[model samples]
Target: MIEIKDLHKSYTSGSSKLHVLKGINFNVGQGELVAIMGSSGSGKSTLLNILGILDEADTGSYNLDGVPIKNLNETIASRYRNKFLGFVYQSFNLIGYKSALDNVALPLYYQGIKHSERNDQAMSYLEKVGLASHAHHLPSELSGGQKQRVAIARALASHPKVLLADEPTGALDTKTSYEVMELIQGINDEGKTILIVTHEPDIAAMCKRNVVLKDGLIIDDVMINQQRASSYV
Candidate 1:
């Protein structure tokens, strides 16, 4: 449940503004699994940052699950971010000293959820991502795929409405990437809205819809027969 109209974002490049997203219009419906495909400098990362509430667009509108997203104070933005969005990144972003379970439970800690309740919830999410047994492991002990699964578990622990993954498979090998995509596909099948930002064609093909970006604009948008990631996994 995302909607954007004429969204523009730019950054200061010395004396000039480096426009990254120029008049971009985009939409993703509930339960839709969409891939944002782009080469370097395509502004996909910028758009993802805006969608995740990590950055603000320079102009135009963004509505998420019916609420306008713009100019939010840090408090409101943090609340909305916790309430509606869960993010997975290429780096996994796990704390070095935390166990997988602890990493997943960190978000609930911010919500002030009690230790016992949050731990139970985090365990359930880890189970969902097939990482329950590995909950005791640290990121250092896990393989790349295992680390990503832990990240996915952490993202899902909050029961977020939208799962935003940027280059989720970028750091993994091909087979591992497929496995992660398969896991994501299973999550999407259960009615979660998902948007993946990736430059990999195979990764994008696994999604139901693909939006190709070029030079800060969406140059192609198409719905394709979803190639089941399970097939590759």
Candidate 2:
């Protein structure tokens, strides 16, 4: 569902330019769960930003689900981003004062959905994420895993074509991380495409495909037998 070809990006600091992505090519199909692994300065974050439309490449092409993802104004970019992408970050990125349901409903609100309808849809997503009982809880009231589940629910509430997770389990303990991965695997099984940017090997093993980047280049890309997260949970 994603296409990238000869992607190159660079940042200028004073007289020197730091090349982040160099002649990179990658593609992801519908219903695939892929893990992107890289160390610091590996260009993984830059790639994710481009994929999420949070940043643009200096040169090359990116097409999301057949539509070109380049040279758009911020307004159009935001619209496409809301329409096609869902994000789950390491920080959870939930509004502190908002309840889980409201946080999930926030995107729908931006889509201009009616208040009643947005809340209904939000609750349904919450139920899907096994957080219905905690719907009224604020982020502060919930545990770390629960907060992440709410964030996932928020991401899915928009019915995004691809889910992009950055360090989804970075803050949680072993058991909680596995539990969250189990939920993610379940979502992938239901035919939603997902891309996870992570540094952990065990977490990468849970995905169907793994792509490794180093020095702004893809050094390894392979499909492997997927490990079910449920076994660990």
For all candidates, the clash counts are 0, 0
Q: What TM-score, to 2 decimals, does candidate 1 have?
A: 0.98
TM-score between model 2 and native: 0.99
Off by over 4 Å in 2: none
**Which runs in model 1 stand beyond 4 Å of their true positions?**
none
Candidate 1 at 64: error in angstroms? 0.5
Q: Tens-digit lDDT track for model 2 on 1-233?
A: 99999999999999999999998999999999999999999999999999999999999999999999999999999999999999999999999999999999999999999999999999999999999999999999999999999999999999999999999999999999999999999999999999999999999999999999999999999999999888988
lDDT tens string, model 1, 1-233?
A: 89999999999988998999999999999999999988889998899999999899999999999999999999999999999999999999999999999999999998899999999999999999888999899999999999999999889888899999999999999999999999999999999999999988899899999999899999999999999989877
Q: Please estimate how well model 1 matches the true structure, expressed as its whole-model Cα lDDT.
A: 0.94
Candidate 2: residue pairs that collide: none
The model with the greatest TM-score is 2
